[model samples]
Target: MGKSSTSVLVILAFFAIYVIWGSTYLLNKVAVQELEPFMLASCRFTTAGILIFILAKIMGIPLSITKKQLWNTIIAGILFLSFGNGVVVWALKYVDSGFAALEISAQPLIILLLMRVLQGKKIQPMSVIGVILGIVGIYLLVSQKQIIAKEESITGMVMIFFCMLSWAYGSLFVAKADLPNNYFVNTGYQMFTAGITLALMSLAFGETWSAPLSWSGGVQLSMVLLIVFGSILAFTSFNYLLKAVSPEKVATSTYVNPIVALLLGWYFLDEQITAQSIIAATILLTGVYFINTKKTLAIFERFKR
Candidate 1:
């Protein structure tokens, strides 16, 4: 019974990260239509972070951390949430959610290259092939004339590329950083600080803010789901699955999320799934698989959408 129950929980956790995290792309797309991008991220992270902390306290988990840890969490928060997520939300104003998800699916490739450059890690032969395929896939996707013709689309693509860089570097940082020992506490601090940073970024950009009550029903629902499901439930499940399953199994989300986002965007928003995009997604995801086949970048897996 004990083993069966544990297996059930593990399966459910995988569902949460796969479906819920995948759906966040659509949720952010919906919310960004009505809210300032940074502000949308701010509200989601702030509310979720606070709830995590409150839950931690209720469960008698320690919240204390060293000064160095606090500072590291702040940096991680800014990299992973304030810029990585917030900037991607901003890009959704000009880019299709599914398209953005596809491009970001190159994240593991980016992390692998970064490891080569920053850490002097040798690319395993398989990862080297993954890198070549990933590059070709990205070129095929981004070189679409229709997408590049729009100036704003081009700009959104560029910014999202930078956001991927931030996320990749954050993963490398977190792997070695002195963070809170408990994953939940580390995430709480990161989210809370990133929330505050995003709010400031919103204000600095002179973006207008509105009360939740005044938001459109769809946007409001999107925000609620993003906060409670995308930010909280799915994230907690990710942590749980990291303990309960192999890192390679948990890493499957990296490939699955973009596919989910693509399907949802097509079904709900009538977003076109171009033939070229299909080719690109297939190639890109194949590359991600080869990269993760034998190697584990568990920290990199943990941080992305």
Candidate 2:
């Protein structure tokens, strides 16, 4: 593809990650109203996985990964999807989707800390400052009077924190681990493994699928949207962007998603957007910007010197 064509595709991919993934938080909130969290996740991933697998096969993508790669992919899948995503789905029962998005926005900071601790990666001073600011933002968000007024909201926030941690670890692990060169094949296997695991978890938790059959149109539509837009399109776009653009540029989705989620939640679900939320979001996103954009900032500082 020409440079211009690639640029357009990159921009489209950014839209998928920023808007579509952001929308999934609310869609998941709607889905869990009728479908249990694990069950809902299972269905969404299974459907998306199957479709992606078929597409990969048709595209002649190599699927012959080693046994170690398979096992690593499965482990990453469980961490990223079954735990990271499934837990968030369950927590959305108690937390507003907007708040869940805000909490998840701390993921880049968490990933930096994990890399520093687990891999002995040296964090820049500015990044450390960013991490500190992010923590304070989280505290402010969770300690809001409205959030503290409800015990369930506190519990939900705690669960979302764990969810973010799992996602960060999974991201780091997948990046380091050996996997197939083909992004579509890798994603297909991961989603398939996660889907099967979530299905078993749903059965273990005694969740039934009957509720979805009788769900309202809105809830049913949300499920379809989650499977199509959230899983298939957005995930494929993200995988493409990983190759097409700088990781730092792709990481900007973490900053954009929460804002989109918050606005959608307010408009569609009537989720409250208090002054506290605005202040907290500002602080949190500022920290994220610093952390992700550290490389560019360093270059600018050097030029000044």
In order, what is each prediction's RMSD in angstroms?
A: 3.7, 3.7
- Clashing residue pairs in candidate 2 (N, C-alpha, C atoms within 3 angstroms): none
Q: Candidate 2: where is the Cα deviation over 4 Å?
A: 1-9, 211-213, 241-251, 294-305
Q: Which runs of model 1 end up more than 4 angstroms from their true locations?
A: 1-14, 237-252, 295-305
User: For residues 25-56, what per-residue lDDT tens digits would candidate 1 score against the true structure?
Assistant: 99999999888999999999999999999999
TM-score of each: 0.89, 0.90
Question: What lDDT score goes with residue 250 in model 2?
Answer: 61
RMSD of 2: 3.7
Clashes of each: 0, 0
lDDT of 2: 0.82
